[model samples]
Target: MALLSHDAGGKPVRAASGANATLYCNESTAGLSMLHKELAQLDERVQRLIAAYRQARLERKRALQERDRLLALNAELKRRIEGVVERIRLLESDQAQ
Candidate 1:
């Protein structure tokens, strides 16, 4: 059993659930439509942001892989330099002898 009431314009408005509450046709309907539109726009914006975030994550992953590869190459180069220095020291010691 829904109760019916009238707005200020004397138009019979449907009342919401509860006692003595009248729904303003213009305000409620228009506001809801506007809110729905804004929500849809916000949803689309969120989807785009999510896609961008995923792309950034993929880029970050590739960058990390490249960094790891470079670090390994640096370590290998450092080891070779150390070996060359040891060989030079050994040769100089032999010459001194």
Candidate 2:
């Protein structure tokens, strides 16, 4: 007798295939049912954790991209400000001549 049976979605459950099937008591069946429930719950939690990890990875990538953009922008602004300050110094020197 096969020790397992599958549902439509191919999930396995303990089963007895032959005449001795009724030998399993209600308590054992209940225990098996509880174990299956706990396993399913764990599976769900693991999936949720995996999804959260992926989201965090994407957020990190986005943050890095934003940081690169801001760094470039800051460099450009500093260069422009320095040029403006040099021009002001040159103008002030020329005015004093």
Which candidate has the highest TM-score of all?
Answer: 2
Q: Write the per-residue lDDT of candidate 1 for residues 20-80, one digit (tens) a residue.
A: 3434544667777998999999999999999999999999999999999999999999999
Per-residue error for 55 in candidate 1, Å, reads: 2.0
Which ten residues in a row are the worst by lDDT in model 1?
A: 17-26
Give Cα-based local distance difference scores for all models.
Answer: 0.82, 0.83
Q: Residue 24 of model 2: what lDDT?
A: 49
Q: Write the per-residue lDDT of candidate 2 for residues 1-97, one digit (tens) a residue.
A: 5545555598865656455465543545786899899999999999999999999999999999999999999999999999999999999999999
Give candidate 1 misplaced runs (Cα > 4 Å): 1-26
State the displacement of the C-alpha of residue 64, model 1, in Å, after optimal TM-score superposition.
1.4
Question: Any runs in candidate 2 off by more than 4 Å, and if so which?
Answer: 1-24
Cα deviation at 34, candidate 1, in Å, is 0.8
